[model samples]
Target chain A: MQPAHSNTVIEASKLGLTFQTSDGPVRALSDVDLSIGKGEFVSFIGPSGCGKTTFLRVIADLERPTSGSISINGMSPQQAREARAYGYVFQAAALFPWRTIENNVALPLEIMGISRDERKARIKRTLDLVNLSGFEKKYPWQLSGGMQQRASIARALAFDADLLLMDEPFGALDEIVRDHLNEQLLKLWGQTNKTICFVTHSIPEAVYLSTRIVVMSPRPGRVTDVIESTLPRERPLDIRESPEFLAIAARVRDGLRAGHSYDD
Target chain B: MDRFRDKIIPVTTLLAGLVVLWYVFAVIMNAPVQRDMDRRAGEDPRFSEFIGKTLAQAKPTLPAPHQVATNFFENTFTRKITSNRSLVYHAWVTLSSTLLGFAFGTVLGILIAVGIVHFIALDRSLMPWIIASQTIPILAIAPMVVVVFAAIGVTGLLPKALISTYLSFFPVAVGMVKGLRSPEILYLDLMHTYNASASQTFWKLRVPASVPYLFASMKVAVAASLVGAIVAELPTGAVAGIGAKLLAGAYYSQTIDIWSALVAGSVVAVLLVTLVGVAGRIVERSMGGRPA
Candidate 1:
């Protein structure tokens, strides 16, 4: 987490979203209250349909909250999105097939009408940050799944937005790749000092990466618990095996099971 | 050798089988006509002579394969190219109008697809009409297009090309409509997150995504354009095109000329579609062989 002197990057109060379908109304998110400080790594951990992704999308202005209010920095979500205040990484790489890795990363910069020289510079910097510098000229299909996801992260990072919202960016990768990416992500987060709101279903992933974990449950789709990590700022992959890490992970798991209705 | 054994062998065997069967049918079909001709001459011929006579009838119901091949060769290479009798001249006339119509049809189809994709009003209003237009006989529309354009003093290539455009545009419009909308929800949502403008989304997302679809439809459209060009020639009574040649041949009961014109048309159709396929492959390679 950033120092206590830092301002809140994201704030939500009783935020709700209900999707209307032919079957009926489905409450994807309800009464979600959370505030993320600058330079913090926060993870929303939940089972399927718990609105973890919905909340992230809401912050990105891809979905609007039906009730209460949420703000990014001082502006509303729509305003923040329009201002290009945050970068979003999706579940899939979502790379355009025709574009090379560097060009894919340059997408937002192109949209924002950045100059050619600046776009080239930012593309190089972001690709380097994701450790994808050499694969610049290659297509998305040419790379491995993990590499594609990393390229996608680089794409989100290209604009240098103060906030980064990622929705299961590494979910499709294998465990070994996931662990390596998790480590690389934490390092990248350290280097960039951006506030990151990540959504994932993996228990260890949330516990390993987040400064604070938001455990959610379905049915009405609401937050049940928030666990602040007690680990040191500097951590290694082996930290997951430690008693302190396991204890926090167990608390997060319990919070999840308590809120989840397995019978239903 | 493997390529020959695996690919060419099957194709050649099927073709050989077809030719043999065609020869058998030719004899069966021409026998009655040949019998009347031979009887008029009071000829009593051997079995082989009788068989040869049936297969070589001047106006056989179904011309033998060799007879059609000979006609194809004579009309294609033997005649002076400047003469109206030249198959090359007729083929060129048909080809020129077909190509012009195809170009217009492709541009019109893509425009309609874009309008349908971007505007709800066009999607609701134009798409059904675009689809419904195809159901009316091209034969019915071909003459009407010629008449209407002639009435407006828009004669020659434009009217005939308009018919080609009419026939070719439907497949492209439908294909491109599906292609433009082919991007998944996630990709669109990615654009939404970026807050990209409508035009940016169209160019960056829709256009590239629709290319493969465009080429697939183009192959179908080119063949249709050729048919449209030929059909357009039919009502005009123009004596310079393959369609006119077919009409004149039918008028004079010159069965060999009709067969040769048809053979020429088939060869042109194959060439046009194959040309499109090659273009598609080149594009596919340039885009790294996977368009999507």
Candidate 2:
């Protein structure tokens, strides 16, 4: 029973990861430090080779950090994971093609051994939250890509974990669908008040949705900058045109350019 | 209706062409025997007489299609089903062995696949041996299997089934292994995030994913099992089943009997494969997989 007022949800100190491949040992992340507070939407933004997704994976306990430490809710990532502390949405929807949308959403609940009636209630509620209520009986391939991703989000939200780790969940979508989903996601986040750690390569997306943006560089990946947003929590899609949003976007762009220069 | 038309036209054309070719070959092959018979009777037969005689030979090298079809119909329908002389009785004996062996082989294959997928040591050690087992021709081993089993007083269906099991299990083992490992790494990571036990992952993820592969392999395995069952009957000198019928026909130069038995065996194979396909479709649909 930890205190409810504690704001820190995830804290990483000097964390690093290196993968040993047939060619050589490749460092994916190095000397990273960050902390995400309760109910904060933190986005990790960088170029393709950057370890932003790796960092998210570390927090999810999908990949082990070779150095330093990361704690989720004051517990080791592994312990936190075992305790069902968070839900993850992959870059691809990654829904099981054999499962209908409703069954896919209900997967984690089934794994957690929830009773049938309760599982049904949570599935209905979460699908409604993602605006996917009637599409329950449809298989994943039958739905559009954006719909599939929303179902994936519904899957993540089904069990109602306190934290959500999303890795470029909408990256494959078209711009219109991406914008629509981003708006929906923000609304969902506001309503749920869950801490979200998102990884993406898009600057506008980072500036629009995040409370703070952590910019990272590739090749022995390390964080280059962390920018705090000054925008109000209740943001409209038009806020992308505001001078404040432009300023933060410019900073993220400059940090990205500076990260490229490190190779020289 | 268009789909049905698309399938029926080509198959019907090919079958008609095959029947025409069979009549031509039967005439050519039975000609020499007809010529010898005419000479012995001191009668110079006319071309029309020669053609008629060749088409209706008592035992041609390749029996005419109509002759074989007549034998097939008569043997299948005119005799009591329980009579040893009936093709239905022999086909039933062979089918029973095929089905039993297919069941045993499928279960064994799935178990082996599970072991190989779950244990790296088994994958390394058992996989090569499984592949090697298939290289020794079933024809060579069938007789030995029959002899050994007969020594142990295990005759008839069990020995034939053992050979069928041997031939059928390989495809299923290989396919199931491929299927069990088919889910991409990302899905496995998803399972890990859920803190799912290994058993949970296997049932909910691995088994369902492997189903399509299983059905494809079962089609191959069932056909092979039938071949194994027929071959196994060869060395036993058994008085029942398609293999025994073929042997008896060959002993008496009943080419019509041999050809009819071959056709009956083919019909059984098609029916068995179709049954497996229907089962696969139902299971896949019940599991919520999309139709082909």
Candidate 3:
């Protein structure tokens, strides 16, 4: 196992992706280079159609980048997938409606051949971590949207995966729900010590959650700016009122405008 | 009260209207007109009584109600399961074949559905043929199937069950295919992220997801199998089954007997369908297990 202090958990170079659509060969991404350090919370903030999701898909091996080499923990993304290196949460909660909250959380552990007793213990712990202990018996439809999403995060955490990939997981929630989830997510990261790569469109959310924010441009999407956060490690809800928070928010805005005119 | 008024009241009113119309026609239509024909036929002066008895035996349409009821009692209670003349024996013969056939068909349907879901070529090629197969009337080709199987020296339950299987499988196949594909794209991506293999995804997601659909389709399949078994018996000129009894009564102009046998067959079909529905509920509940 690599040391926790190792700076890079994911490395991508000269990554590109193209789709053969009816219109023509559409270049979805072009010449992307990025790295995520161990135990770091990196957020990809970009305009619509900026290929942020696509990049995440590539890293997860759900899609293969048309060009460039990428590795997760020194293995190819596909290899990493077989080894179950990371857990991914999507924009939607994506809970299996047929399964209750507990079963949904237990799914990955079940597949990974964990014994039943251990699986039960892990599921309870993870559900509690996401504040969903009482909801173990509830089906996805019975819960509020935010609760379903928290269950999804708990599912990702249950397998003890070292890396977590979240694609706008709270995008559909109300602002209040999103804020609560954001705080919980930070605590989850702190406790689990997992490297995270989150993709989103919210400027404040990106700036608030990320240790580093990678701003991306659209139309052959590419990274334009990489900003390291200057906020204190001990952040609370009141941090949003701080001048430092406002300054970083302003920097993210400038980066968004200067990199890509997202309103196309 | 409003919910009941909105949905049930209209339906009950319509059904009541139909029953009233039937009574009016029975009492009012062709009373004297049929008297002239009854006299011309010149059976007896008690012609009205004869018509009444026949109507009571077969139904309002032909023989009547009482005659058919009498025949059913005679065949089912007066005789026995081993008796060739007994409707109970014939019904048992038919039920056994139908039950076996339904089981075979359900298993085959699930296998084919799973295969089609997993393989692209099977999905493209097999599905069209399955749809087309149902359009071909069972009545048209039942004799040919019987003859072909008989020629090959396959006898007894096999031919009857094959026909039942043929009729029953289509509903299960269609239901299962839809169920297997019912998961949203996002859920599939979740499986992909978990690095779940195709088989793992199927057992944990697709198979469990398909349960409600499977049970629903099973009800249809069971009913279809009963229909198939009865139809299969017709082509064979079966001597010891309900279909044979109906055919014999028809040839002898025993209209009351024929009508009674048809009602008996319908009753059996309803019973079988009801059993399947109950079983489906049980299976669904069991597979769902104790909550989470």
Candidate 4:
């Protein structure tokens, strides 16, 4: 295996996607070039219509690019997807209401045809990682919104994939819960050492969790700037108030503001 | 216990009220014949005697509840099950056809639904035709179906089952289509990200998601199948089922027999529907679905 620091998990070049609707073609992403290295926590931050989520979708092979090529670990996204290279967490928990938490988390594993004993062990370990150890018997509706999202994360982590693609997984939660989850997520990253691509609209959230932030603009989305954070890997909630964290966040904000002029 | 009481009380009250109204209507409708008989006999029948005769007529226009019940009890219990006059025997005959047709209909419906959901062309082309089939009255077509089947030498239970299948498959097809498509795009994407095979996605996601819809449709389908079986029997002039009993009653003007056969048919329908409901509860619970 390649050394972790030298391994590149994702690579994209001049990628573009345009959706053809009855009204007309809507350009969701354009001219994007990005490379995410192993163990990197990258945040894609932009406005609502911006292609942050679309870019992640492209990486996950859920959506295809209209132009340019992208690869995960030197393979096409489709091939990589078929190989189960990454786990994806959506904005909504999206758990099957019919399935209990344990069963929901075990879904992908079951699809992969893993043995029951192995599935049980992984489920227990992953649920513990998300601090959801005892709530396995409860259904998604029985849990709080935050807890549901965590369960979804556990589902993604169950297979021990090296890469994770999260699309605003906590956007629906309140401030207090979001803050708590942000810290827990950072700790999760530290423990698993998985490369993460997160999409968010919040500046502090992007700054607090990411080792690097890619600022994007809407209307044929293009990458405006990519800012590398100097903040330590072990960041606390109060780190959001620190000067180094503020400096990185200010840069992301400025990049976003600069991209708005592209529409004019 | 409180919830059970809440449901039982209203149902009991409604049923009692219905029985009272039925008794009143029976007395009014049968009164004229009784009075004419009294005049012909040159005897002035008292009001009390008239009321009693109306409620106990041998061939009243609308059979009294007790008269129908007594006839039903005698036919069902006093006669051997093998007797041609036994309501129990006729009910069993009709019920066998109903069950066979219901199974065939459920299977056909699920297949059609899977096709419609999976193939866009089928959805666009076949769905409207399936719906239009239901618009033609079953009564108008039942005789033709029986005659056609007889010409082809397909007699007995199979023909009746085919008719039931025709009537019952529509609901299952429509419901299964809706259920298969009920999963959100996010869930579909989740499956895609897992790189699950098409069959895997269908069995794990679509089929399980469609369970509630399937059960709901089955309830309707079972009732429709029972009706289809009865209708199928009527046109074929079959002499072994409830439909045959009705035809014989009509020929002899045995209104009491007709009413008793009607009640027996209704009881069969209720039992079939209840069986489907109980089955749905068991499957849903085992699958960890919401409690009823």
The estimated TM-scores of all candidates read 0.97, 0.97, 0.89, 0.93
Better of 2 and 3 by DockQ: 2
- CAPRI quality of model 2: high
Per-residue alpha-carbon lDDT of model 4 for A16-76, expressed as tens digits? 9999999999999998988899999999999887899999999999899999888899888
Off by over 4 Å in 2: A1-5, A262-264
Could you tell me which 10 consecutive residues in candidate 1 chain B have the lowest summed lDDT? Answer: B283-292
RMSD of 4: 2.8
Q: Provide DockQ values for all models, in the order shown.
A: 0.72, 0.82, 0.48, 0.72
Sliding window of 10 residues with minimal summed lDDT for model 4 chain B: B283-292
Candidate 4, residue A149: the lDDT equals 96
Candidate 4 on B148-192: residue-level lDDT in tens?
988999899998998899999999999999999988898899999
Arranged by TM-score, best first: 1, 2, 4, 3
Off by over 4 Å in 4: A1-6, A261-264, B151-153
Worst lDDT run of 10 residues, candidate 2 chain B, spans: B283-292
Task: Point out the higher-scoring one by TM-score: 2 or 4.
Answer: 2
**What is the Cα-based TM-score of model 3?**
0.89
**What is the Cα-based lDDT of residue A115 in candidate 2?**
95
Model 4 CAPRI rating: medium
